[model samples]
Target chain A: MSEQEFTIEALKQILLESAGADENIDLDGDILDTDFEALGYESLALLETGGRIEREYGISLDDDIFTDHRTPRALVAAVNACIKDTVTA
Target chain B: MSARTVITGIGVATPNGLGVDGFWAATRVGKNAIGRVTHFDPTPYPSQLAGEISDFVAEDLLPSRLLPQTDRMTRLALVAADCAFKDAGIQPGDIPEFDMGVVTASTAGGFEFGQNELKKLWSQGSEYVSAYQSFAWFYAVNSGQISIRNGMRGPSGVVVSDHAGGLDAIAQARRQIRKGSKLIFSGGFDATDLHLGLGRSDRRGRLSTSSDPDRAYLPFDAAADGYVPGEGGALITLEDEQTARERGAQNIYGEIAGYGSTFDPKPGTGREPGLRRAIEVALADAGVEADQVDVVFADAAGTPQLDREEADASSAVFGPSGVPVTAPKTMTGRLYSGAAPVYVVSAVLAIREGLIPPTTNVELSPEYAIDLVTGQPRPAPVRTALVLARSYGGFNSAVVVRAAD
Candidate 1:
């Protein structure tokens, strides 16, 4: 698999593992902007999501992720950037 | 007037076993809770053994909605809290959210979560990092998670006073009750996994590298080196006396009769005048003479200097006589914030069952001889137990637990 594909698959796996979302979480869909409850999760879900992604991808994130990436779309962007950086790193 | 507080419920997750029943049973038989580290590969790490509660799976406790957000320690907190609430005869929904509080402690929370995030950031690009990583492993996650889960709207606080935080959290809860809070779900939880933050500091010679469980935590013996760190602490539902009576809960385990805490002034100082003061204050608060304490629950930090300081303080208090001393922690290593509550729980059982579990690995030598209970367990009717604890670096705490009829 290309690094990009690996990154996408990895992010999906992380989302699936953490959120327990079986269906592919559409990175482009507005599902990105929903609160965890709306996305069917407790608020702590996002932290776990970020945690799982950091572990599998091997990255350190800034503190803002907790407050900055509120929407699903914002979260997707965050994940995408982490995945890209890890691939390059 | 200070309200009298009683422990109506207890929740425990530890290496000895899961839940209060298993934990109490294991210690009753003087069973060892130590084993080879499996949470992470230990092939290259200098330390080989730890009192690990790595068996817990979050799926078992969290609701489908909250599963993703609960960290391992928080997950354990939920389990223990549920168990304790049930034991106290109080359902989560039964209590008015505003009337209840949770005082939880963690030396570090979400450590595994943080470590993983950092790993991803270093090996992968910075873009790979997740912001949730920030709070996943902060020091306050335990209390935060408990409050969120139980919907407790009362006062909540976290303590980083090292391992002693467990007992101190309980002491803090009792203080809260005195100040008019109706209930408190209080305790501590910590996890030191295989990730980078997990074993690095301990492996840096902070942890005893002994492979044998029995020999690994010989607290107070002349050969003491260091303590092995472990996870899965305990919490109890502490309520004021009038409240417990109103609820008709009669099986009160014990009373949070008294607590004392003092700092050693500076880290790594052999001076422990502060430790002595803490003990004196706790005893004074309890209104009990030093000799009146049936047995002394020691804060046996396997560090040689700390052990000596504890022995000297204890000896000075009781005059080195027959006030039998035991540190059941030796069998399970040190659980940091998890240790004291587990010990306090064990002390309650000892009072109820009429047996004092022995300290596992000790063949006492001249340097430290305060009647260390070792090799075999002892039978004694304990009416009151003075539990002592000192945190890593330098926090000291003592609490008095008395038999509840």
Candidate 2:
């Protein structure tokens, strides 16, 4: 799979696993537009997700990544961009 | 007047089990979780065996945000606290922000994390140090992080009285609830089997070097030599009776009926008065007679001398061969600051299920003449339990828990 696809899949799996308490949000829905808060993820959960992504991909994310990308789709895109920039450099 | 404090919910991340149900099930059947150390290569250490929680995956347990900033110890604490809050049916947003509190006990705060950071600093450079290096090992970090994560804004504190602090944390929770806090998260946990932590245990000369898992921690046994290091912790929700009633909190485990603590500075004697006195005081505080206690959850220090002291103390308080005694720590090993709360959990389970969990990895030592429940679970009406704990460095504590009314 392409890096983007992998990132998207990874993000979805992480959300699906962590978002057990919230029954309102559909896990199969478009993750890009889904607000994580609506899915029962507060700041702590989001930060933990970011940390896992950083460790798995071997990348250091900007501290403000949560502010920059509030949804899983945006987070995956940002991560893919980070990997691309690192590879190109 | 102090409010009546009762344990409304319990959560545990033990080597034997991850939650209260699993933990109780394993304890009920006398399942031991000790094994060859997998957290690190055990070849260099004196003890090759430990009660390690190898199956816990932090990312799967906690939020992604907490993964980088916390250590295994804190992760265990947070997960246990989360379970406890769910068990209590409490939502921080639903209650008054200042009505809840968090109190935890710890002997070594994030020792594994601190050890790695220090290695990086020495082997690489100052620049290699992680930003979390400073806060990771602070003993109070567990209480602080739990409060922050749950947005609990009431009184918070951490007890550092070695393993004995586990019982003390619960005592403090009752005190807090009496002082007007509606609910308090109380108990203790530790993950200190890293090289640094292990080296300290090695220097103390109390860790069992036995590579065999079954023989690793034989508390109250004739062959008992020393304890094997264990990791994990327990956290329970203690709520004021009125608050629990008001919130419609069902599933009450038991009440923190009474507590007492004493210290013994002189270490050489095989007999100690402090443990006995603590038990006596605790029973008196609860207004219960010695014969009324259904079972005594021993400290089960596993050292030959310490085990003798604990047995003698029980004998002194409850008469010879008194009130079915058990030490389920033989199953989970001693988890330092996490030990007593886990014992408290076992006692509560015994009370709830009316069966005393057996003491595994032990042959009744003829030396102490104590009637230890072993081999299999003993069925009896368990109404009250007295849990005991003693720190290696002289702190002795006892807490009395009774079936919730």
Candidate 3:
């Protein structure tokens, strides 16, 4: 699949895996609208997840991505943009 | 009646093992966990061997959020606390939040973390240093994080009283429980890997420079020279007797009968009477006599002078016959502030199993008329145990633990 095809579901899975099985996170509904703190994630978790996404997508992201784009959908879009930039370059 | 404090759960990240069962099995057979240092290059230092928790991967054990905020020492402490909580069958929200507390100890907190952050500031820029670096290196970080993570909002504190701080932390835990806190997670862990602190502090010529793991830390032996530094920690669940019984906690390890601390008036100022006094006070506070102590977990400082002082102190307490002494730390190098808690865990296990784990890599010195248990595990009715620890700067602490009556 192309970098543009990266789905919000994929990002949701990453967030769930990062949070661990014990955490009470809802994956099916409005994951993009959910606050990371609501999912038992803190700033460090967001930073770590950002790092993992960067590695997985073969791209680099700004340190402020978590602050600027605070949801899974927004993070996925940012990740996609980075991946597309890498591919085009 | 005083609020009786008991160890209901034990969690340890030692060089020997991870949890209570693994630690007990390793200690039972006198397994050696010290090896050549792998965390950092040891060529520049005098000591080559260290009892490091090489297998631990903090990311795998802890929550993702804790990864950035924790140093290796804090990770070890949190993991041990996790194990202790699990072993006690208690979860974060299981009990009343205000009734639970934490009391931990550390000598060198996050030495490696602070060192790395300083390196970033030196080479890159001040902006490159992570924000978490500020609190991550503090000695009280473990207690604070453990409390925050577990929702334990009761009276929480940290002890910074050298290596004996581990025992002192436990002593403080008992006091907290008596003063109203129903449960407390108390122990100690230390890491000296990156040399921001401990490496420079060993200038007193006390650390062992031996390259061989087997001969590196032969405490109480005639050939004893110095001790190998180690890294790790152990935390135990200290609960009120009524609280534990109410929760149906079946595995009661032992009770903290009494604890005492003394200070040697700065080395050479006087005969090191602090250790002797600490032991005596602990026994008296426990309402126990020296004869009632089934086993003695000795400090076993390994240095010729310190070992002699400890031996003299033990002899002074136990008299001519002498109590059976063992230093299981031969299996894992002295973990600085963490040393005493693991020894406390060992004592509790010894009391439960009715056996004294042998002190490995030692030949009993003829000069010291102490029955140092060596070679193999000794079967004994260990109804009570006396554990001892002393810090570098004249501080000494002792605790008397008794099997549940």
Candidate 4:
């Protein structure tokens, strides 16, 4: 499958696997614009998620990706963009 | 008079058993948990026997989020902390967060976790390493993680004096209590896989190479060789007597009455070892005569020279076979930083139950002028107990526990 195929569902899976979803929050609900702190995903948890993504996709995620993409929607877009660039190059 | 410090709750993950009841039951019966190492392949190491918590599955006991971020030792410590809080009937918000503190001890830190990350950095390159490596390998991670998870914002610290650190951490917790903190979680735990490998490679001379579990770690025995390393430990919930009484704490285990520590004199100076002085100071601090101490939990190094030194020290303080001494660690091996705290747990339980647990599977040498309780549990009127521990680098520490009024 193309690296561009990275989706919100994939990001959801990674987030759950890396940091675990908050007990009270539902990941299936509308949470795209919600802050990570609200979802109980702190900086360290996001760093671990980034590490897993890089290892699985064979791509390098810039350290700033964690700060720049604060939610699943933004992180998914950034990962897809990096994958597209890697394929094109 | 100053407020007394008592241990209201205890949690343990030990080779022989888990939790206070499980560990105490096994210990009372002299159950042996040492065997061929199974945490990792022991074929490569000379000392094959170890006391491993063979049945512990961390995923079954802890939240999944914690598994990725923490090392095995930290997971065990967290569970122990949870058990301690539950045992004490104190929830996170039960008391003000600022009134609770954590003081823990660690010798190997996260050796298994660090070794795995270092392997990735070497063979698979640095990019393959996990981000958790930033703090997971630290010696203070146990104290830090316990405090963060429990929301304990009061005084916190980690002691790293090897075996002696267990008592040192308790002493530190007592100090925090004296400084006005209402409650403190203290003690330690160790995960011995990579640490055991390293010990075999660097200090194999001090580890038991025997394959038989029964004969592997016979401290004070005529056939004693060297100690078998073990994993797991205990975390105690300590509160001021007035606070526990005012809060109606269910089970007051005993009081952490007194503590003393000293470093051994440099070799060749002809100055005697400091173990005796530490014991004397602990007794004096407790304001009790040596005769008042009903039992002694010996350091029991399991090596002839070190065991002789400890025996001599005890004999000097309590007279020739004056006090009944036991090393329940024979069943669990030497747990490094975990040893002394577990002994403290045993001591308080002994005081409560009026029984002294045995040093299993050992024939004491007649040459040592000390009374070694062996083979079976000894029923006695145990009121005050003394626990002793010594580290490889000459650190000696002693703690006194007594029946709480």
Candidate 5:
């Protein structure tokens, strides 16, 4: 089976499922550059999302991913990089 | 004089009903909510009946985000807190954040959540467990979740004295109010069914094993067995009386006049149980004479030995049948840490309406001289009510609630 690629759409789904979207913020809009905090996702929410990603994708993620990937764009890219490393290695 | 602590709002989630109005209505009419445990299969257990809030769907009442992080108990507590805040007609932002606090009680913490996580750990490995389990399984999570949700940052805590913890937590909130906090959300809730199995094996020997709901938990009855376990409780919005009046609080339920707690001496010591002392101290603290107490809300453990002890204590303190005693918990079962606060709610409501709710399904044995109010709701001038609770490990607590002037 082919591996699923980590994308902004995937991250959006995970964010919504893990933390739920803020009523005031539109998750479908250009939220790639929006900070998770601005999107109403806090550290605990990010931790849950990261845990879900690791379990689903068979990859381990560092806790600092929450701090380093503050936006959906950065988190998607970081997750895709980890997936690629797992596939190649 | 010290500032008086009064309950301004009440939110309830009980087996018989939800919210203050629904619960009080069912309680006053002596409705029984105990039935076969449907939360899970009870066919294998000896004790099949419990007071379950079968219709409560947390997802329907709470935000989706909270659904992922909280256990059923915490969800119930959060919802109760929301109802209390709304009932009080005061928003968290209306008061200074630092002026509000949360003090709650928990006996089992979030056992169902912890049990689920443990199952995941054993079957799918520890990595499969949800990170939310970290806080969800904690006893203090109810207080923490309520605090975070309402921005109550002044002082927060969870009392864990089992059944007595409910009144203990409210008393702690009273202390915070005395210390100048304007608003405090206090009370407790429990949704743990882990002990049902123990009750089956007679390990605790404190659960009713009858299949028939009507005869299952007959406290003070000649055929009394033991208590049917239950879930749900209440969150009371307690405010400094002066502050509540100044803020134009629409309803002031009653003043939490006095509190006293004591631990039972070792069983083999032959020392008297501390329940009587607790009641006396509470009356002294409230400066109320024993004869002045209009009604007594009993712990009603439902076991013969414990029932006799409670009856003896009440008779000794109030003189034989001197005060009208009731245990509306007969309708809801013993809710562990949640029991006392609900009784407190009943007391406050009784004070307001001057109608004492009845102890349903219980036939007081003539051997006990206490005047147990049963069969029908008693109409009387209830100006002051005393609530009593005793925990499994011999913790006893008493609180005196009086009508606000």
Candidate 6:
């Protein structure tokens, strides 16, 4: 599938698979510092999103970018960087 | 009533095997459970090998009423707890609910459940996802579900110190027992058996990608780079000495003689000072000196630096005198929260059997100098055993187990 075919829903799927959440999650969702229950997250949920994005998208986010990327919108931007890198490579 | 706690029975559903008989047989012979992921299509993933508890059938373990509400981790706990209660000869209805409490550890909560729901929502939309999906993926999900299912009315809690929380939960159990309680169920189980948790660790570059199964989890080895994530559950029934004797249900795996825990301000230097301190505290708590420790169960984390920290802390406590140390977990990938109880079980068996299983795949090391067991298991008359664990996030727990006298 082309990069254009990957919608925000597709991106959400990638996020959900990689780190463990969905587009229904607050793009401004505080997945790192906040109580996941208040944010409606439980049981190894975030890991699904984190795993998929790193493996499928080829994004090597190993340097503690979690501090700045507190929200899903910020996470999306970071993910886009990985997408950019993958497209360029 | 002398508040001494003993593991009356143990039930395990781990990557190594399904039940206690299977688990013990696999572990005693030193079998490796690492393999490519089969539960999901892991073809596109970075790390191919993991210690997956793929053999477990949940409905086989959980109560019919509670099965619908429990997570995979909870299912593992319920099954193990049942085995433990039965192993101790404690029937479900026979035990007093008010006297029993559960202290457990969890790292992932319900990643799989959440992932499945998200899949339905992403593919068929939110309408396809079940409303009960809300309860399946939270950290407290397992503890609450297990307690309600088993009718455990004592203290119920879940520790969150990464994987170290597993061992730490047991430490709290010991404390509660010491402070005054009848029977305590203390153990932990974690399942990140999903792409999300796996992705996070992979993105953080924390897991081993070496395709070779046997060579994947080389704990304390020089080339040991990272751990391969895994899942499983272990539980034990701890009863007060008098209470156990009065009921005639005391096989006594061992006593939770002493327990200690500490936190390092930052992940800097070998957490030796803090770990050494915890060791000292546990030894004192158990009323035993360092030399009396016959065998040491090292949390050979399969991460180079962490392993070194553990080795140094141990050497400082035991003082260079080769106190036979073993990390049987090399056979299974580090279960994090699942590691401590599993190690404790091995320690209990080591005390019972007078043998320390070998540390699998330890070719060499970079700094720490505690005699690393390699190739095969070592037989020794272990009177006392120490299980030391340190978490990557924050938490160091030490438990001392003595030969049941």
CA lDDT, every model vs. true structure: 0.76, 0.84, 0.84, 0.90, 0.90, 0.74
Given candidate 6, what's the lDDT at residue B367?
65
lDDT for A45 (candidate 5): 85
- Candidate 1 structure, TM-score to reference: 0.84
- The residue-by-residue lDDT of candidate 2 on B54-91, one tens digit each, is 78998787865566568899999999999998888887
Docking class of 6: incorrect
Worst 10 residues of 5 chain B by lDDT: B193-202
The sequence of per-residue lDDT tens digits that candidate 5 reaches over residues B102-151 is 99999989888888888899999988788888899999999999999889
Clashing pairs in 4: none
Cα deviation of B92, candidate 4, in Å: 1.2
Off by over 4 Å in 6: A1-89, B63-65, B267-273
The residue ranges of model 5 lying beyond 4 angstroms of the native Cα positions read: B194-202
lDDT of 3 at B243: 84
Question: What DockQ, on C-alphas, does every prediction get?
Answer: 0.17, 0.07, 0.12, 0.59, 0.57, 0.02
lDDT of 6 by residue, B185-247 (tens): 888888885688778888877788888888888877878978887888688777777677788
- The whole-model C-alpha lDDT of candidate 6 against the native structure comes to 0.74
In candidate 4 the C-alpha lDDT for residue B278 amounts to 97
Estimate how well candidate 5 is docked, as a DockQ score.
0.57
Model 2 regions lying over 4 Å from their true place: A1-89, B267-272
Pick by DockQ: 1 or 2, better one: 1
TM-score of 2: 0.83
Per-model TM-score of chain B: 0.94, 0.97, 0.97, 0.98, 0.98, 0.94
lDDT of 3 by residue, A41-80 (tens): 7776566567557656767789898888877767777778
> Candidate 1's error at A42, in angstroms?
5.9
